[model samples]
Structure formats: C-alpha cells, structure tokens
Target: MTLPASAPAIVVEGVRKSFKDTDVLRGVDFDVPRGSIFALLGSNGAGKTTLVRILSTLLAADGGKAAVEGFDVGAQPHKVREVISLTGQFAAVDEILTGRENLVLVARLRHLEHPQQAADQLLGRFGLTDAGARKVATYSGGMRRRLDIAMSLVGEPRVIFLDEPTTGLDPEARLEVWDIVRNLASQGTTVLLTTQYLDEAENLADRIAILHGVRIIANGTLAELKRLLPPATVEYVEKQPSLEDIFLTLVGHGESVKDRS
Candidate 1:
C-alpha cells in the first residue's frame, strides 16, 4: 500500500550521539516513510541501537535533530510518545500475568475504552485467544513475544520501534514474528526495526539502511543497494548448512521429514 504524501513518520537529520570519548552516531540521517517498514542494519555495537534510542526519545542527541510523526523528539517528547510505541530487545510481558491480563494492563494504562474487550480482540488477532487465559510463564518464546507486541498495540501507535525483536528465537519462531510485522505494515503502522540478521532485513524491510562506523553508508531497496556493486560472476558453489537448516531438518514442521535410507 502507498503511504500518504505527507511528512515522514520519522526523520533524523545529522543526528549525532557520543559516550565519553567514543562517538556513537556520526551525523547519521534518514527518513522513514509513513506506514512502511524500515530496517536499520548493523553488526553488534555498530550504533544501530544508539540511533534507535535517540529517535525513540529514550536518549538525547548531542547534535542535529530528530522527529516522530513530524513532532520534534527533543522539543515535543510528550507528543512523540503519544504516537509511538517501542519494544526493546527482550520481551517485556510479565511472566506472572496471563496473556490476556498482560494486554489488559497496557490497555488500562492507555485508558482505552473497554480494555478487556480490546485485549480479547488482540489475543484473537494474534492467534492467542485459546492461550489468553494461560499465564505468560507457561507460554513459549513465540507466545511471549506475541503478547509483548500485542501489548504495544493497545494504544494504536502510529509508529513502532522494534529493536532486534527476534534476537534469540529459533527459525520457526522468527518466521512467526515476521508475520506479525507484516500485519502491522498492512494496517498502516510505520515500523522501524534494527536487526543483526541480514536475512531478517531482506525478508521484512520495504527500505533498508546499513549503519557502519556510526554512519548510514547506504540506504535503498535491496535491489538498489545490490546495484551499487559490480556485476556478479555466475558460479556454482556448495551450500553450507546453517544451524537453522539442521534444526529444520531434524524437527520438521507442517510436514513429515523424509526418511533417508
């Protein structure tokens, strides 16, 4: 779906951040279109998280400017907070609370009308209605993550920042979370995600920006980024199996594993 021709949902212009003697963000900048999924890619300690924190208003920038939904993050933090939701590296759902209870808590906190009904609708939407009454402590990794995102959605945020949302999940669980991200984009919510997995960005991002040395070295669709490189020489190479491939081979889903005699 096409986003409206309005100001970007999030904008960072020459945003800079530093810690003591180390510079974290060196004049980084980007524009995230409204209702689109924008992926920020970087290896560990590459300043992706720092940039995310600055844009989300959790941390202040040393120089430059940032905004969310056209509201300045530093000058109008309350307005920025009103239109954005964030889920960090770890799932924030309470283990002691039932899934339904967890969402209801956020709904009530948001002062939503009829919080319980909202919780039920979200639970059903995420395919967790049957498990809604069960305690989050008993839920699997995927279930807890789903509840965390569901909780974030209680207030109907216009923009959401997901910081490495699939960090430790297995491949199948990761795919499960991917579906939810897709659903958010389809529903017209701007999503800004930072990920270490290149494949995750390839799979989910409508636009991608690669962060390196505290800067955005490249930004474009995957195909546009690829075009910057020399033409590839077509050659065949042996495919090495990743751990997830082995995991899938050993623990098949939606189909029976083939018997290799």
Candidate 2:
C-alpha cells in the first residue's frame, strides 16, 4: 500500500539477514508512519525477531538500508539507540526486585535525575502503584508484562519495539496493555511490535505487515489486507458478536489515558 508524503519514523529497504546456511530475511521492506502503531505478524521462524533485531540495532543486516528517526541504524548505531527502546518476549524485570525497584534500577541506569520519582511515576502509570513494593515473583503474568514495558519507557524513547508484549496476558490484561500502547501513540510515540495474535493487530496496529518465507508477503491497513483475501462465498445467516466486540464497547465508554510522560 502507498503511504502519504509525511516523514516516516522507520524506513527499511531491501534488508537481508542470514544465519550460516539459512537466509532469515530476504529483502524485506516497509515504512512506519510516525506516532502510529505498526505490527509485524509472522508464522514461527518467519524472521520477525530478526528484522526487529536489525531495526533495534542489536544485530546487523547483511544488505540494504534501515533507518530509525532518519538515523542510519548500521552507520549510526549509538544515535539509533538513543531514540528507541525494546521489550522482549519475556519479562525483563528481576524476579527478586520489587516493581518499584525494577523501575528505579532502569531509570538510574539511564541516568535520570530523580530515579525514585521516575520509578513511582511509572508504577502509577502502569497501575502498579499499589503493588510497588511486592517482588515481581509475586506479580501476575499481566503485571510483569506491564512492568517490563514500563521499564523500557524509563528513557521516554521516541520509539519502542515490543516482541509480543501481551504474549501471556488474559483478555482484560491484554486490553490494559492495549490502552498503554494506544496512549503512547496518542502522545506521539512510535510503537512497533511483532505479535502472533491477529486480534491484537486488528485492535492496536495502524498498519500491519505479515512476514512469510523470509519476505513481507502483505503490508497495509486492516481493510487493505482484508481485501487481499478472496471474497467469502458463504452468506452469514446471523453473525454473532465477538468477546472483543463487547470489550471494545465497555472500554469505549469509560477509558481514559492519563499522560504518563
């Protein structure tokens, strides 16, 4: 799909990566609009994380160009690092540390002036204020995921890469994290996440790119992607609403995004 003339937050072109005899990414390409959520979907071993690693500057691409916020990821690695954060598939917080401690540790490492205040503020933003002193070992899967993403935000990054941010979250918790991501985008931060969940891509992503066989087979808005499928021949006798339908209705009524930044 053709994007507008606005500047892109991410630009990837003809990117390639290989692992020994295997080619993981074969000339993948896409652009992410600034201040929007872009999702990468792929089957297992389809090179989603490899592309993310290249974009996040954790791994090098064998060929082609990648830039984040206009800084060449290959040529200006440090500059690229300055503008983005990454949350991996699993929680990155230390199980021994309390939620607040985890934030303070990350904030102090980032050299924030008021580490404690920064930690407290993040706890409140992620709805962990009441559990601030509890060790992460006691935290639920959803709570741990929230803390992980919160830690990634300690630096107020312009962009964040979430590798399945809601992997193990329950429906209610998934909605909570969705709110966090939406709130982030609403406040002008670019969010790029690789997810296996189709509903997540539908609910959160402004654009979706599907990776298959080391290449991006599809890239576009949800509507555009739907158009790629052949029209359904079967008529719907009486379509029933999904759980997500009910959830969206409830959330639409009372959701509020308190600016954490």
What tens-digit string does per-residue lDDT give for candidate 1 at 1-261?
A: 223568689889999889999999999989999889999987799898888888778999999999888789999988888899999899998999899999999999999989999999999999999999999999999988988998999879999999999999988889999999999999999999999887888889999887877888788887776555434443464333332232223223212112221
Runs in model 2 lying further than 4 Å from the true structure: 1-5, 234-261
lDDT of each: 0.84, 0.84
Q: Candidate 1: deviation at residue 55, Å?
A: 1.4
lDDT of 1 at 101: 94
133-230: candidate 2 lDDT, tens digit per residue: 99999999889989999999997998899998887778988998899999999988899989877688888999988787788877888777655533
* TM-score of each prediction: 0.88, 0.87
lDDT of 1: 0.84
